[model samples]
Target: MHLLIITREWPGYVLGGISHHICNLYNEVVDKGHEITVITGTCPQSSHELTGKKPPANEVHTVQFGYRKGYYVLFPIALRNYLQSFDFDPFDACITHTGVPFELPLPTVSKRHDCYEATKEYIRNGLSFLETIGDRLMGPFRTIVDRRSIAAADCLIYNSAVCRAGWESAYNITTPSIVSHNGIDTSVFYPDSGYNKEDYILFVGGSERKGLSHVISFARQTKEDVIIVGPDEVNSPHVDALGRLSSDELRQVYTNAAVTIHPAGWEAFGNVILESVACGTPVVATKNCGAVEVLPSSACVVTSEIERGVMKAKNLNSEDCIKAASKQTWDKPAQDMIDIVRSITNPEC
Candidate 1:
């Protein structure tokens, strides 16, 4: 099957887990012998520099969409024009990884990695006064777009049950959806046998909703060093901000850290937790997030008990971490996607 994937974040332009998710799925689908084309947004980083790895799309067409707040409103319009101008045979299926395209000739499947409603809830609960006001002004428009996009799709795919529930609750509609968890690349993120682990704690995410403030507070109370890797630069006496690291470098950090922390109030799916476990590192994650779905109860703890969680994680066996991570890989989810697309094209099959 020839597949066309539309996403704002691709390899080299990775904004978060969604980028990695798309890239990994692209690689797996291609390896299975399907021709793939990607319509993605522009990013400043070159393909090679994105992750010290080349992008996997067989054909990539970039659009000039910026990553600012209101740019998504124009994405479907720009994408519609681009597709109209392109001359090609019909694609078997078009998968919108983030949101639905304004128009598409092929069977369209919308994949929801994050729900706008959940994001809005987070903003309302966590943002400053100014930010909250800004969200209020844009809320209606965003809601309209989000509803139309989801309703437009022939089928829906969600990264987690939390994401699906949030969308359904927000829109007051229950569309049939596939709940497929994101996977990790074991080859790149697996345990490093030679390097000795460190005593420092690690946190990877740029947003305040990712529980950065909570992690900082925990770091201040503990004597252990805290290393942060993300787009945001955090300034705290107890925290050392590395900004962002390549996949290889991040793998090393995960492998060496005593424990990784994910304090996010909510996540569609927490790739960081899986990545840390895949690297033979235990994680201390908050309850009520998507990580709870994949992580064992032993590894998950309430946010208030993060310090104690860290102590428990320290004694977790490295092998146990790897074993838990091994259950999730790109193969299953990629194949599941392929089957969904095929079923859409040939319902009798």
Candidate 2:
């Protein structure tokens, strides 16, 4: 099968949730003996992101997109204009970042990683007063785009059930959809001796939306070390900040920590939850996190009581966490996607 995948946020450039999903999914699909053509936008590399890989030669097409911050609103228009002159007849199907303004003849799957509703929670995290007001004023426009993106696709693939449900509640969407949660880069993250049965607690989050308040509560109560990853700084004496780590570095952190706490209140799906457990560290997340759907109480606990939850989860059998994570590898989602596409393209298979 030949697949045409389009995204403005590609991995190895912009490091985020969607990029990891695309990179891992694309690799797994390629290994399954399928051809892929990727279309992407710009995300300049930094010193720490580890360059040397780009979109595959001849298979990738790039458009000089100008508004990086406004990509969500502007990218669809850019893609629509670009696709007007291009021929997509050769590809069997296409998967887009979220949605295209115009529909394609081939089977179209929009990767609804999250909905606009998710952005509203940023106000609680760190959005400035102006930004919050702007978000409020832009509600109508955002709704239009959201509805179009879903309507334009033949199907929508949500990264989590929470995300899917959010979209349903926000838009009352009748679009055909399926939940396909994300997977981790198993090459860099797996059960290892990185922890060596250590006693430090780990918290990975970039902003307050990732349960920063809850992390502070955990840090204040626990006498153990609290290692923080992603935030620029945390003034607490109990916290040690490791701002922005590479995948390998992060895997070590996940491994070394006695438990990784990700009490994200606004999360659709917590990839860190999967990554932590995959590295033999149990996680403490909330019921709001969609990834908890696959994890057991021994591997993850869904509660707001950070201290007790960590106590319940920290010493869970490593094998159980590993077993749960093993089932959600890139290969699993890739195969699920292929099956979805086949079901759509070949109804009688």
Candidate 3:
């Protein structure tokens, strides 16, 4: 099957978990005997992609311009010239990650990675008057595109059930939504990997919705050595800001962590939890994410039940956690996705 995958960010242009998903899913899906064409922005190398890998697969296409700060900056006009060079034929189907505007022929499937509705809580909880104004100016355009993106898709796939439900509530659109949980590469992240396990608790947040402030507050109160990895670093004594980690470095962080902390109030699917578990590490996550359904009985300790949860996580065996984490591989989810595309593109096939 020929698949065209669209993402806002790609491996070298990492912005969030969606970047990892797009990279891994495309690689795995293409490896599994399907032809894939990836469309993403071109940016500086992220800490995620390892140093000298082969060039991208034959079908991948990188669009060079992207939004930065509060504006869209076009790359060299030649990049646009390059973008115009390619002609897209009707594909078997196209699967797009949330937040990119890519048109496709035949059955189109959009994967919602996070719930913008939950992110709205961040804006409403308290944004400065200036931030509010800027957001309000941008609101109309975002809403129009978001609605069209979902509605235009032949099918909508969400990383978590919470995300799907949120879309339903927001748009009143009852599209077909499958709970396609995010996955981790167990080969890269496992207990035996050489990671320097530190004494501090770990927190990985890609966006504002991960509740970084809450994690900082908890760390400050407990005075625990806290390592926070993300793009934006909130200044706090309790936090050791790693800023951003490359893909390999991130796996090491997961391998060496004492306990992974996720204070996200509302998340679609928490990939950090899965990555941590793949490293034979336990996680302290909120009960809200869709991935919580995939947690081992012992590896997850809910934030609402902090004390008892911490105790349970400490007691969870590394071997058991690894065993449980092994179930959701890139292949299985990609296969599930392929099946969805087949059903939609050719019901009679």
Q: In TM-score terms, which candidate is top?
A: 2
Stretches of model 2 off by over 4 angstroms after superposition: 43-58
Model 1, span 115-189: residue lDDT tens: 767766665766789878987888787777787787778888888888788788788655457888888889989
- Please list the Cα RMSD from the true structure of every candidate, rounded to 1 decimal place: 2.8, 2.2, 4.0
Model 2, position 234: C-alpha lDDT score: 87
Alpha-carbon runs more than 4 Å astray in model 3 = 42-56, 64-66, 69-86, 98-103, 123-129, 193-199, 206-208, 231-234
Ranking by TM-score: 2, 1, 3
| Candidate 2 lDDT tens digits, 1-349 | 9998888766555635666677678878888888888777663431213234333423777764666545666677777778888888889998888556667878888888766686577543486788777767777776777877788887788888988888888787777888988887767788665358689889998677688877987888888788899987887877988999888788888888888988877678888999999998899888878899878887888888888888888769888988888877788779878988887888799
lDDT for residue 42 in candidate 3, whole number 0-100: 60
Q: Give the better candidate number (2 or 3) by TM-score.
A: 2
Worst 10 residues of 3 by lDDT: 69-78
* Model 2, residue 340: C-alpha shift (Å): 1.5
Q: What is the C-alpha lDDT of each candidate?
A: 0.78, 0.78, 0.70
lDDT of 3 by residue, 277-330 (tens): 888888888877667778867777776544455556777777777888898788
lDDT of 1: 0.78
- Displacement of residue 252 (Cα, Å) in model 1 is 2.0
> In candidate 2, residue 110 scores what lDDT?
86
